[model samples]
Target: MPRILAVDVYQVAMPLKYPWRTAYGEDHTIETILLRLETSEGIGWGESSPLPQPHYVEQWSAAAFLCLQQCLVPAVLGRSFGSPEELQQAMAFVKGNTFAKAALDLAWWDAAARAQQKPLYQLLGGTREQVPVGADFGVMDHPEELLPLVEEAVAQGFPRVKLKFRPGWDLPVVQAVRQRFPELVLHIDCNAGYTLRDAELFEQLDRFRLAMFEQPLGYDDLWEHAQLQRRVQTPVCLDESVRSLHLARQALALGSCRWINIKPGRVGGLTVAREVLQLAAEHGVPCWVGGMLESALGARHCVALGTLPGMDYPADIFPSDRFYEEDLGDPPLVLDRDTSGRPVACPLEAPGTGTEPRPDLLRRWTVNHFHAHA
Candidate 1:
């Protein structure tokens, strides 16, 4: 039996020079909750909580982390890595606290993969070696800011760019970027900024030839999205609202959206994420993995899941170097660049999620700390 050695939570802040605006919300900094799980044999890492943004899942908070430290960790200690299903069931008692449960569930998977000396993706039965990636750019103050940003991202080798869209800014921003980079793959994420009244505006968006329009209506309003899907030519993709496999099924059954964005933390963990992906595949609804500015630990998990067979769309899994000043992993997650200047692969060569924390970087960015049992 493997005894749990420790569980530590750290809060880190990454400041963005300019405000990152999106239809769902805006922010000047990214607040991250980093979780480290250690056993007598090895260590595993995970991240829960969004970047203190309103639109993303708000289920995680500092108080929730405290709850994890006090209650969840103790329950998980001394557990064996019998199987993913067994570990998942063992943690099922911590229901109604998905974020906290996600942190623990992800860590357990990481540890199990390490114990077997296998990559996380291998454990998940995915092996395409690579998945297409796209950049999710922040909304700029001026539409003029987009050309240069698009050019810069293109120059840096991003295959596609998804711009943040708000009401007044949506058409102009897409048109400007399209005019400059007519051949580039361009998509839009409304973050649920539009209402039924704005459904006609999507016709205007059709002129720009967007790849997709994401979450144009309220997060929870699957019925509204289904109506919008009927009215619009551009395929609709749901983000925040599809929290569980059941919600995903509801959205698919109603024809709410043609695409779904799977963020593991929001869905509970990779366990639920897999279920969502399986559901999407069964229904023939396309899906892609979404990002939340995660550290290497969390990003690796996304990469592992994104490598599945039906994940045909470009994922938002950019390399850790793009956001982190210093990474948790020694070899840091590398984006395998191709001669065409696009990232072709994200390798998971190391065991587990293939990430280990840098103590020095952890010390500099972590502002708060807490410990839980086991």
Candidate 2:
């Protein structure tokens, strides 16, 4: 068991190379909460990126920071946790701040892996050396502009590509991509932008042959998604809706989705992430890891999780340079190309996530920081 002795929490805004426009809104910078846990055995790092605002999910960066500073940290600062699940249990009293709890859970897992002298993937029981990663594009100024980017991703040997789908940028854009790259594995993320009434429109999309429609309904919805899934021939993939193991089970039982996009922070952390992956696998549902534009520190955990069995689809993981001009984390992630030329990512042999925040960048980008001692 490792007893936590101190904690340092930082709220940072890492500038993006390009504005990431989604259905909800556009973000020029990714605001995230980072945790450095000092345990009896060693140090660990964790990150949870809620957008600057509450549009994507109810938890935003500032609120997640308060939840950790005022409640979550006080509950577990001096406690010894035998496992990440135990750490999660300690924070159970505070509900619905999965993003806040995730920072702690992820830190604990990183610490445990380091203490055990193993990489995070091995600790999570993943044996795969590398996993294919897909490229994702946000809403561009024009659909025609998307063609060149998609072409670049294809030229780089990416296996799949994801486009951000919104009302103004919907059918015509998808049509253009499908027409241009007829054989590319394609998908569109609605980001909870549609309702069940749009069934006719989604039905219109079946011809494009998308890999799936990700989170087409409300962020907290399940039944409506089931309705939409039943109406559309294309596979439905749930993202914002499946927040925990319980929600995952509900979605599966209702046939709400054929695929699940597992973003560790969205579902809490790696502890629940693993449970959700297992549950999805048992139900024969394909799963893939999604990114939140986190730095290499946070993305590294996602890359490690992608190697686990049942992660059938290509992940949303990207190299450091894809989003940031200069990575905020040390030893920025670089993609590897497989024999067939598909872009892939592998967990570093170093223990834990194999990356940490660069102290200078951490100091420069931090809007606020909280420190505590046990």
Candidate 1 ranges with C-alpha deviation above 4 Å: 1-5, 93-96, 155-157
Clashes of 2: 0
**Candidate of highest lDDT:** 2
Candidate 2 clashing pairs, residues 3+ apart or interchain? none
Error of 2 at 242 (Å): 0.9
TM-score of each predicted structure versus truth:
0.91, 0.99
Poorest lDDT segment (10 consecutive residues) of candidate 1: 53-62
lDDT of 1 by residue, 1-374 (tens): 55677888787665554566777677766666777788776777777656664455555456557657766777777666555566567766765556667777788778878978999889888867787788778777788767887898888778789988887777877888898898888899988787888888987788787888888888677998999889888899999888877799899999998899988877778888888888998999879988777777778888888888778788988676676656654557778876666775575777888776678877877778887654
Write down the TM-score for model 2.
0.99
Q: Give the TM-score of candidate 1.
A: 0.91
**Lowest-scoring 10 consecutive residues by lDDT in candidate 2?**
77-86
